[model samples]
Target: MGKERDGAGQVRPTTSLSPSAEFPPLSAQDIETLRRLGEQWRVEKPARALPVDPELRPSRPGAARARGPDEAFRPDQPGELTATPAAERPDTSRGRFALRVRRVLLGPPLSSMSMLRERMRKLIALPVLSSDLLSSVAYGPEALLTILVLAGSAALGLSLPIAAALVVLMLAVGASYRQTVRAYPHGAGSYLVASDSIGPRAGLTAAVGLILDYVLTVSVSVAAGIAAITSALPALNPLSVPLSLAVIAALLAGNLRGIRVAGNIFAAPTYLFLVAIGGMTLFGLGQAVARGFTVIPPPPVPATEAISVLLIARAFASGATSMTGIEAVSNAIPALRPVEWRNARTLLTWMISILILLFVGLMLLTHLNGLVPRANETLLSQLAHRTFPHGPWYPIIQAATALVLLLAANTAYNDLPRLLYYMARDAYVPRRFLHMGDRLALTNGLVALSVAAAVILTAFRGRTQALIPLFAVGVFLAFTLSQVGMVNHWRRHRGSGWRRRAAINALGATLSAIVLVTAAITKFASGAWVVVVAVPTLVLLCLGIRRHYDRVRQAVSLHPTPTQLTSAERSEREMAQEFLPQRVHHLLVVPVARFDQAALRALAYVVSLGQPALAVHVSPEDQEADRLRDEWTAWGDHVRLETVVSPHREILEPLAQYIAQLRERQPDITLTVVIPEVVVNRPWQRFLHSQIERRLRRALRRLPGVVVTSMPIHLSEVHPQATR
Candidate 1:
């Protein structure tokens, strides 16, 4: 062996033919072939220079490129990558391995536009869609009687009256929504109808109301469920907030698996709740009527307060929560299987009938048995104890109640994302909200709703009553707006029996408006001001969202596609080109992690492109600055090193400022930033690597003309490249 000098006078090892065999001496042909193989590898080391063919062996699958290192990060379909890759994160890395585990628990990813087969038939859609409305019987009478008994026993008689009025409001709202299903079959909500008929301002206001209702529904239902859970298992009382969050997470996961799957998972609990409550109603009524509705009233009211018209109206509005989720069936018509409208209307009727019977019966039983609400425990718990006594069935009743209430949040999971999808299609929200998740469900919207609800539940300390006064406002607001929209629909299309339809909607609008005003006034001091502020604020946000989308459309809108460009225009090269970027100024900006073989290889790769390049160094102090300066000089000084001084020892900001200065100086140039990165085979080795390149790439991308690219180096053997 001997040493030879490279172009830079660096000594390299030279190989010669030789033989060394353990068992026997090798032949001359074998020795010659081995010598040639070693010489070929020595002649093609990438640290010195790229080979003639310039092919790179990447360390990771899908990181290798057939083109150039500059084009490795370029997306295959450039202009059409609006959806994020995380929604469909491949099972390739540790992060994706965790995602793969989560997917196993949450079910597989659903494809978009494949939800046609995922729709629910009547058998499946009934409990899936009606759980919220039916579950309200768990609290509807309690919210009313809690307010009625304020007169120290004189007010107890008014419970029946308030209950009757609420039932009427439920029927009116349900009938109006039923008509909504018939008129607007392609998914009708207050936002869609009010926008199409009553104008966009009314429509967006309705949208805000629907959003608030859905969010509050999730918070209230989950908190109430947790309350029931803690009541049954008193040991869990201290962990109420955490338990509420966990239940929300469970509901979120189930819904993300697609509607049919989630519906089946939730069906058993809903029917159990129905049987438990329905059985209690019959038992309490049968025993009460046997004794001719005789009851022992509570002793002298501890607190003496008079009841008036406003008090009765407030009580009425609060109890109307039974009707809170009645609009869900109509809002989710598109989610029904084939007979979308017919199945929806049928489910709407079944839900209302069940709601009225169960809710009204529960109210009457509370009247017959003389149970009153207190601050510490829910009235449903009180009724369940009275109906079942300390028996074998009591725990089952409580379990069923808790399960149904928590699953009630599935209503919002189903409707809110679908509604958000509509708004996104019209550019009223972020465009990504329009994407159907891998499971053909709205995963992003589901996550957003869950986070917001979890925050609200935490802030309120998981108390149901605290969230109760904040309810009813959004429900009645949406109800009123949807009714007004339907009135417009009847007037515009006067097809058949339009008079009856218009009058029905007009009546619903009047009744719901009265409830809206009553609820807002009664609960204003009890935290309803938040809703009052939120409604208009959300309306303005939606308006701002629309305005921003319009501006972006104006900014990015091409006057004409290439097909519209004339031959003269194409020849001029101004009006039309294939990609519309008339010129591309390749500016390679490399931020060196350290002056090593990887760094030099990346620099050589960029220099091969023959573009104006910048190599930036952000040093922590003078000593390190001097050290890097010497290191760069020792690496053969092919490109001038640009030193950026950082008095504050910042890494990304100074480099970002330098890039901004470059942009201001070269206003018409496209700047491409090239970064050097290393890939380690073992996943644990990645944690030891510096993340400076990632931070710099993120910060530099905000500039208009800047493009970020990466050149990867492998620490292990050269990996065979693979395509995604």
Candidate 2:
């Protein structure tokens, strides 16, 4: 046995050992560690020894005990005890009660610093930035092919060179936006830029176009994604529309739940798709370098050669479509971290890099594969078959390209709601869109996107190319307005060396504007006109809404009045007061067979106040009135009671007759007519209740020698907490 010191400091439990018989004392460091462990253990232990007041416990599973500086009080149930006079009522405590619980779950109220971090996190999650940006990869390629297809198979060779130009321009544009992100990291994308720069109408126009495009983005992206899935699984081919809608619903649910969760879910697939395409591009490039210049050959086409400059400009316009959702990032600056500018810039850089790689990769692959576009067909699908050898990889490449095509609208899905939120905050749209639900998700905006997308999908019948002409026109219109705004913004701040930058930006704006004109002219009949019309209509709608809000504000003006009440009018009020009894001993009120709680409470209160109560009943049918009189006959000896009957079954006539009789009998005595009413708690509840008090009050007002007192008593027990 080992020897140990007992609590009394005496040696105990001795065991023979060859080693040292006495143990050394713990070192200072070891003592500290043991002390820390003991403290931690104490802190983690249950609060069994702590004093617990029996009254502090919850009365039931769902019940909460009140807490206050004073002892908590529970009011007696209605009818269980008589109410004391108002003068004698107990004073209720004016502080919140303590709650008895093992733990409380809540973060400290957000400080500005915390808020700034949350904002940045939310900005990154904004679907518009990621989904919208990635989706561009899908259709940006398609847009390029659609244009090249018009110029002929040989002209399609120029696709890469043109794409190369666009790619350089995209990088320049991306760089320009980097400045925008830093400058206006507060959010409200192109609309803010346009409105402040160009004017309200232009800004509103941009907002409408962006909003419409956002809706289209969701529909197109989901449809494209579905189309890609269908290409891989022929069994799911016919279910594209329905499956697309289901995917939209799932996305809506995910987004509505929380932006963070949605971000986590969509980010991996989106990045994967990006990497997969990037790898395909690298593989195709490697093939070209190894195999030398051998064209993959093309599918059947109308012509073997290229097209005109007008057609080429139109194709460029189509290719420029990829830039549509770029503004969505600037619009969502408020959602970014405290360092919103940095985060947005980083996100933009990521976006721009991916966009360049995608644009170049697809164009190069298309040229190598010898793909040509028909007036209506997709070139990626056509090119995929030619570029990749006729093997298992052939189906894989086709499937991936198609998937990218379908998800291209992902950018819009993210962007539009953010646009809606800003517009709503400005009162250009419904205020509901700005509401963030319990999970801090833009639930309303998500729902709106889902519905609008479904409608567009149904309207277009999921034809991807059919929506393309209308698509880029809005994007370019927004871009032009944005560029113009930037130019003006810089000009205003000319003192800051922005004048030189302004001129260059103005040139960019002019070029963008010219491109916009070209896009509109070329695609007007093709479908861009629909967007042009739709955008203006949205502007008008927002303006109309603003006008309505203005009218309401104007109507509710609270300006102070200078005029005071005349002495004669004040004397009239004095005269009315003179007629009231100094001490009202008795009051009369009509009673029905089925008296509501308000009426009973009013009567009980009067009786409890040591005043005699009078009851008057009017019945169109004498028998019905007599029956009610009989019910209250037992209490008639304690108070004055009267019943008036009408042979013609008219309530008004009987009430008039009774009032006249009361005036003749007690001209000097106070005749206070008590009117009881049910108070509804909710707006919808008001519609379900009767408006009998209104009509009765009107009738009482006509009496010359009468005092009407509205006695509103508790009906359904409305707790003070309930009102709060």
Candidate 3:
């Protein structure tokens, strides 16, 4: 028999195969039979598994209990069969059993690398990818209004110019990404494109920016959604933080069900929101034009210092929020249907057209009417109320706006995990981030994003305005790097019409750089400084990770030893001199906390093994150690007893250091430690215990040539039958 680890890292046993009896794999059809057998017999626990319950043991069924020489029993569950050791069997304590039931409820474990493909059709792909892009309209135009109103009513007249400039920037970023979609075909987002063209440092810069962007997107979207709700229902405003957290929890659950299911649930809201906004814009404009385009009187401008070029650029920078989610489709090309890139690009085109239609229409209507941003109500909420004045359409538009804002994080939900997966594959993050949970979703990344967003939401007190300044800085930074990288890519490759493509990317790079600087300089005082400090710090960490991986590669490389290995290959070990000691000393030591059935069985098991065994007790002080010794003398076994003094009350490390000294003194002796654990019957009770056995094993496994084992004495375990 030998040891092997399953995909989940659980150790199990394997049997040697002969030529005549090759392993014929079991199929899904045989699963029920295996489960039935599992009910009849307990599985053979592998290394490090807790032992069976020792108290109130059940007598085996008569038929299966009596085995003949030729009768062979095969269990389809993992591990090979062997005679039961002196160690106890599985702890069927209600708590352990309850844990098994809870695991089953969560779902079956996916096979290693068994990634589920959710190739979405174009229809569903639109909402799954564009939720962030389309939902931004709820706040994008308002963001523009927010900046323009700062200079009072005269600056408000410049809304048309600001809106027009933002429109041009939006088109340039959209077209740049469309080219990126074709050039890469696979993910053409900043992380990949910058890595390819501008080197990995540039790529990591983009990666950090995108990570910040995704997390901030979730935070901002949720806050905006809460603003929508509170605007309509002022009474609920007091519960803003709790409401934001609840909505985030719901989104986390939806995404955990998988992207396809999430897309199906969230897609309808995008269409509905589009219709609401589209109808309001058309009717509002039509009514205005029909009444001879009569201008609504503007609010009075307040006296102030002159508006400088910096002030105007700051307004453009603020208006740039409208373009925040435009890069989502490009970043998520793989999430689309077959011919993924082509379908993704087509979907991108539709999203952009609709966005332009609704965004420009709202901008136009804002100019036609004397609308300004209000603290108590959203810009869209005001427009909706004004457009439909006391009708059903007003509430319908507001509801759709709220729903779309809530679902906007779905874009980050879809893309961030995929981004983290890419980062993990490149060794920049922990490997766990690459794993799919039982539900086949990137559960680690999903949960991590949710927690991060929730913290930010609470920290900012659920205010969208407080968080909005931190949004576009990360986005425009990525945009700048992606576009600049593409220019280098096109210039070097010189594909057909490469010069024209290069120029387009160059223009994008230039505009994005300007926006990036403006955003940093204008919003820096208003909290963009946090992002300014964060991106480089994250990039430096990435650099450190790359250095570590490089060092590990060099350490593990076999390139330096090909010739030395040839001489060592001829060296043979004499078993008598190498492994067989003159008189082998097998020392079994049981670590005891008190004298009970647990300690007795541990001692009795080593005695049953017919080895030289002793019981060692660790206590916080000499007084307690002496007391344990005196108690042992009264309730005595014939075995010798030892006491280990732990002055600091540290059980594992002191015992480990003592054992190391013992090993150094007697190099010939082999060490075996047996730990006795009480298995609890309730799910909650398991947490109440310290689980010292686990900590002991962790420490002992680090030592050379030591065997650590556990005997789990179940406090209470229901037998006869349990849910398999």
Candidate 4:
């Protein structure tokens, strides 16, 4: 593959032709033409020179000329190709104070050339991408128990069976995504897959669902981490909301530093949590084996709800939250190093293995030790306390669990911005979301995710139980759509082993759909309705934004045929004619507020253009208009003057009406509205005067065949002899 620049100045990948492909032989005339063009290019190319200070250069006919403030308005002149030395350039750093602060918060900016260096190897990618799936082991079994315990102690025995079912779902979904990586190595995000295989509406629906899922992942993961902290230290219970928000802010700062820095910072906690949980599960199982693998009965409590099919279904739905982040690896394949799809598949397998071992091991240990969910403490904390009753292992386990859970929101942060970038590229969101910051990270999307998560965490008061009901619905909905789309993809482009791939995805889709419907129906009244309503509304909003962009593109696009030309095309053609001075027909209209040095300078520049010039003024009283006319006469009447007297004291309205009339009378001629502006040196001095030029430009932008320009007269230039 090779890279080439498109017309829009973006780099895109192109495939090289095979060596065996046939090509036409070059003729003698074609070879001669190519040789001549190469010689001409070498002769025309400018010579390379070292930068020199403008002040140090000698004053000669062909010497480099210094640029004035007004030079930006004029076209570039030939033989002006000297580079400016850094020392003599204007001090632009004063205006970049905000950029400096961002640098402090997010480190120094990385160049776009360093994008490949930012990719993660499999070792680093595993923990960075699997944190959410791995951290869910801390809460997944507990969520299941919480729902089941409502039917009393008898329902606690059913936890093992429910956990086994969740494991199967995780394996199937993981396998399906592995196939997704192979099929769509570039990116297999749900929106892209569903939009390609299914229709655009289905793709948009999946995009909206995944967006909700990512936002809730951040809020819920932080809340759960805080829950673990308060469980270990009861003194911190009252500070849960504040603590959650603080953790979110920290994640935002770390991620804004770019992908490599974030991955390294967050890599350690996930491994620690895995080791701690893995050790606890092993120790607990060994102790149970010594005790003949007995099942200890849990403490008896009254049943709040009767055991039934509905109750079991709800428990299964809640436990399926463990499968939330399984699809992240497929969506973020590009973040991996070379051989991205293969590395992603290997990482997915490892994640599924670890998640299953921890999830199932914790459930079995809970059943053997007869532990139940408690309001004041988490189940993982309880298991750790029982497994290591006397040593420091319990605290170590709790600390690791809390840290990993807090950083699990990193997974959502990584994938959400990339998804937004894809959507923005397709015009589904604001174009600003497509911009990468100095660090090559999607800064707008990251900030948007942080604000949304903060609002949700505050509203729920950082309670994990309250947020769990709203969690898994969107993720499961996304999973079903993505898998179903893959099935269609395989059927359309069948190759070797295509039938096997389609069957695997079909099974995954069926299982995911069952969970999706179960979660939405069981948790609807609790909080799932919010997601149910939000997904469709967001889909419509995306479609509406796309429609608006389409209309704007059509209105501004140029056509090759003169009869089909748009206003923009005509304006561009007329602008080109400006260089042909003999054929140019333009009228200059200068809007004067009062007769001052700024207005006089603007009038002088307009008169120098040698075009028919007119000066217009709007006065609230008749006396003001009479005084302005007298001043123009005293100034030698360089240009014609037209004054309008208004009783309502409207400035922009009268100026706009006059310009519109000019355009109406001479429809074929271009009207240039030049306004003189006073440029203040100090920022605070700006509030002292009216900004009429700024407002007038906005008011006149809607008029056809009329161009607006500003002629600024600096305060220092107006009073050159004044003291600082």
Candidate 5:
């Protein structure tokens, strides 16, 4: 055997002249037969051709059963060969599986400062965060208004005073949350606070409440804001609910784009809305004080019918909604710059300052501008017209305030997903919720929240008051539990120097819990049942999450010992034995018409491997057979040629039978079937020739004791080397 090159400078097949017969160069008809054989037996193993007859070889008694050689075997039938290995036994070790998981999720060091910065920016801008925060501002007033409604407008004179008190309470809560930001700065807010202070169950409960509140905040606020806009611009009146839903959709899409895009998009509106509300509050206050106004009133506000003292307490409890997003700064403390605690406190101050101004300013403007509260109209819109001196600023202020309220709901877009991401990491929610899209945003959570909020908005027709009482109750429940959890947390950790601080938290928890009960009872009839329902739902969900974690933990646990790698190695070794070594004598059956560059290449590869090769072709008639024989004699040079005549004009059957006869004469000879195959580079080109390849492979697979190899030529796969 000598080194040979195909047309492509790769391996090509050659033939050895039979000792007693001559060889032939393949013609067009001979090549066609070769191509058909190659197609049919492409997947079949070629038989190793040998010079010595198998019947002459001495057979051992036990080797018959051990080697499993059957006398009935045919080279064309692949299934007759018992050379393949058994299946690999699976390893069931937990440590090995865990190593695999780690290799996949946490690969080679790919992190850099730029990547970390990018991830941080993206997480901060997540749509869930924006939607979560903004949603709070929308319903923030409803709780206050409902409280005044139950307590009566006579107590409404005290609404500002009560709001002032609520502001103080909100400040305390905010301060306490600052500690949370410093301690568990994961943007998970209340869940972290409760989980660290109490346990995972407590944490999950807080998470569920926070999530529900975040969702409702988006729905309720958008609905109410739309209503406010409608009150100012009546022409947009028809689309109030749908338009609110539209805003939700747009925000959701923005979030899906990625966190950074959403953050940058929402950040401006969020701050602008904040400034607008702050500006309105100060402008209204300066105007009221400058005008020497003594609380102008258009009419007497309505009084609820002989409300119980408990009702009065319940009504007061509703105002706590003003504190809905009080913990947001703490929740998102991680999004701040370094020196997170100091930055958080400053941010807290800024947020609280703006919140206080908006709450007091809106209420005071309504009172000072003779803007009476109505069942449907916004006090802010009425105040905008009355307090702004009735000029161009009137429409602008009205629009600005409405826009501010709408944009406030965008905060929910940021908060909800961040919190859910944490919950998902803890295995409390579906892992999908933790997925970040290509844009590095929690797109799944954003879409889920958006759809959920839209459903609520549609279901309730965007009524702010309808969703109001339900809002703060769940939040305050978390607040109360968190406060109590903190008190316990502090007590357990405190030394001699912290006794006073512990007492203060104890008092705070005691007071908040009492207020929680009062609010729950007083607001129950006024749609507070929604919060009541939320608590149990959240509890059940947490329990379910715990169950899932436990189940997964149990499923993949490791055993004491593992089996060795003996079986697997043996199986692969047996599979490799089916292939024949080079230097084997064999008859090369080449269908001449099929003998394209691919066939020639395959023949070159087989012959270079030192196998004795022959060319086989079919003849249709006596004259054609004689002509083929003459052509074979002329092309023989050194190789032998064999010809088969088909009487019924069937190709595969006759060719298959000819290979069978050769296998019987020399069982050790490997019959190398040279098939020319077209290699297509493009996807569409594959559709053209795939069917013929499939049919050929299927028929050849049934042949026994044969190994088949396919040699593909680049017809269209490569353009004939680009001529310079």
Candidate 6:
């Protein structure tokens, strides 16, 4: 045995090979062949030397010497070249002004290594995740009352019973989701649960439902927040749509800054709203105690219609929108600190407890104070007035309510992007959604959610009532699917307490399905149909995207045996063989629209490549073709010229057909379409020139074994001497 130093200067033992063993010694011819192969490999892949900063280079005693640039240390071992450190490389892609604006809007970009630091602790996570569920109290009661009020004020008594039922539903869903977090610690939420336990279709259905719910959560939350603002000051009613959009944009900017920063920025308002509501509830109950629990008769108003079972069902369905954001914690378990499942479960429990208390407290106070839904003012606002009519607390509570409502969309902002990222990983959505931005955030998903929410808000004109009907259907659908999937999961993987877990999920599934059906049926005429149609359409879209990706994978995947190739695969294989390096051939074609300096430069570049080059011109008229040929002759005809006169005056189609013909005639050679494009400095100047190269490239890209490249000649570069 002998010792040899490894790449890192670690000594390792090496065993000597015995020539007498099975293998014979190398002959002179074998040694010469190995040497030639090594030389060829070296020629193909030369080692890249990195320049060491003179000040940073370490000095060795008795060997200290200044090194010239050419004498810099070169890596002798293969694949040992050091990459430039990220800290030393500055990205100059974005302009300074654009970067400044981005920094001002989104804060500084966070390194991916800082992901651990970005994870939320319980303090920040609770508010960040629970805002939507908590803030729903501001409008849940109003939606219920608004529906019941259509029948009469007498129907308003059903609010308490409906509220009680909603509390039970919230508990069941929250508990079921706790189990979900334990089961799926990595946090794909309903999509993962349904896909694994049920089927891919079920998972896609659940994902589409969650996606719609998230979009609606943003729109409805912002609209309700604006409603609160307008309720306080009716003068702002005309600007509701604009105000809602602005709030959404602000939320998008905040979240784009990354999770931790958003949590910090949004935490105060959630706590404030909780305190204001809790204090008001306690103070109102105290007043009720002083009055010996008297139920004040609400001021009489004319009944619009007779109260019936359907009216109560519609009210229940509408009020169920309160539970829209409940699944967020389960979906975002990965966003929590260590022991993510436990923290997520704990956070979920706290959210449900707070939500139940606030919701029930507000409902009881609304009854006790005899507050009804009004067009200009929210029920919570009316309750606030009754609780603290004479103090500054009314405005404070109103302000807190408004702020929390607007920011409540943060919950959707947090989970929707993650859910989309999971779907993208599964190839059900566009792959771009899987990418994290410079801030380590799912930027594409966030932007998509923002745009979708903005469109919905604008369509609904930022009216809370108008948007409420479309909200709960998607929410309860996702809940039902998730709970059902969990039930299946518990049954399949029966553990010690599996039966109990199965029972809990079964109860949640039953309740969620009832709510889902109720909402879909009662609110069908009132915009719920939009979500009904949208969900299936989105699901189909996702399936189509997946199918497309699968086909692409099948076509491009390398197979072990040729016998396994399908007919389509065989065709693809035949097309792929044309570009294989074993049969090297090249045909470089330059498409010349006109005989100008740009065309001359492109011809020169192609000729310099020393390949079989041809210059083709597509002219609408014979006179133009003749003129181009004459000009080519005068320019010394550096490359072969072939002009195709198109009497129909189609440029891209004729050129594409000509190239396809070339590829068909010589299927063995690879076609390289070198397009010469005019580069404009100013944005408006691009419109002045014909952008034929872009369209030509797009047309040529469809041909197999045809590579498209552009040689751009900037207007400034066209006349360098003139500029000087």
Q: Would you list the rank order by TM-score, best first?
A: 4, 6, 1, 3, 2, 5
C-alpha lDDT score of every prediction, in listed order: 0.77, 0.62, 0.77, 0.82, 0.60, 0.82
lDDT of 1 by residue, 1-724 (tens): 1122221222334211111101123345446644544443332224555444223345477885444433333344534332334434654677778887877977765554466778888878888888788887787778877777777777888888888888888888889889888776767478777877787788788888888989999998888888888877878899999999999988998888888899989989999998988888898888888888897575456545578898798888878887778888867887888778788889999999999999889888887778888676778888888888867677888899999999998888888887777676566778667666667777788999999999999999998888888888887888899999889888988979999989989989998999899889989999888888899998889879888876675344334333445534553234323223324455777887567666777899989887787788888777888888898787677887888768888888988999889888987777887888777787787789777777787898888888888888887544345211
Tens-digit lDDT track for model 4 on 1-724? 2122222223444211111111223445446644544443322235557576333444576866455642322224443432323222345566467666776899876766688888888888888889998998788888888889999999898888888888888878888888877777766378777877787788789888889988999998999999998998899999999999999999999999998999999999999998999999999999999999998889887799999988888899889897678888877888888887789889999999888888889889999999989889999998998899988999999999999999999999999987876666567888777677778777888999999999999999999889988887889888999999989998998989989989989988988898889889989999999999998999999989888876665444332234334534574345334334344468999999887777878898999877899999999999999998998888788789999998999888988998999889988778999999998998898889887778899999999888999999887677754322
Local distance difference test, candidate 6: 0.82
TM-score of each: 0.78, 0.65, 0.76, 0.86, 0.60, 0.85
Q: Could you say which candidate leads in lDDT? A: 6
Residue 181: error of model 6 in Å? 0.5
From the highest lDDT down, the ranking of the candidates is 6, 4, 1, 3, 2, 5
RMSD of every candidate to native, in Å, equals 16.6, 19.6, 10.5, 7.4, 21.3, 10.0
- lDDT by residue for model 5 (231-262), tens: 87779877778899888877776655544445
* Candidate 2: clashing residue pairs, number: 21
The lDDT, on a scale of 0 to 1, for candidate 3 is 0.77
Shift in Å, residue 246, candidate 5: 1.3
Tens-digit lDDT string for candidate 3 (253-274): 8888666677888899988988
Window of ten residues with lowest summed lDDT in model 4: 14-23
Candidate 6, which ten residues in sequence have the lowest lDDT sum? 14-23
C-alpha RMSD in Å of predicted model 5 compared with the true structure: 21.3
Which stretches of model 2 miss by more than 4 angstroms? 1-128, 304-306, 374-378, 382-410, 495-500, 557-724
Local accuracy of candidate 2 as per-residue lDDT tens digits, 1-724: 1122211223434221111211224545446645544443322234466465433457477876554444344346533432223322344332111111101221112222232334436433543366566566667677777766765566666677778767756765666566566555556667767776677688788888788777877776776666556555668766767877777776776565444445555555555566666777787788888889576776655663358788777777788876667776776665555566687888888888877877777777777767665433355555555556577665666555555444445555556767776666456778677665544555577788889889888787776677778777777777778777777777766657686666656665665676688788988998888887888788899989767755553333221112212434453234333323442335455444244466566677667655546766676777886676665664353445567777776665567568767777877555667776677655587678666666667777787667776767444574556334
CA error at residue 431 for candidate 2, angstroms: 1.4
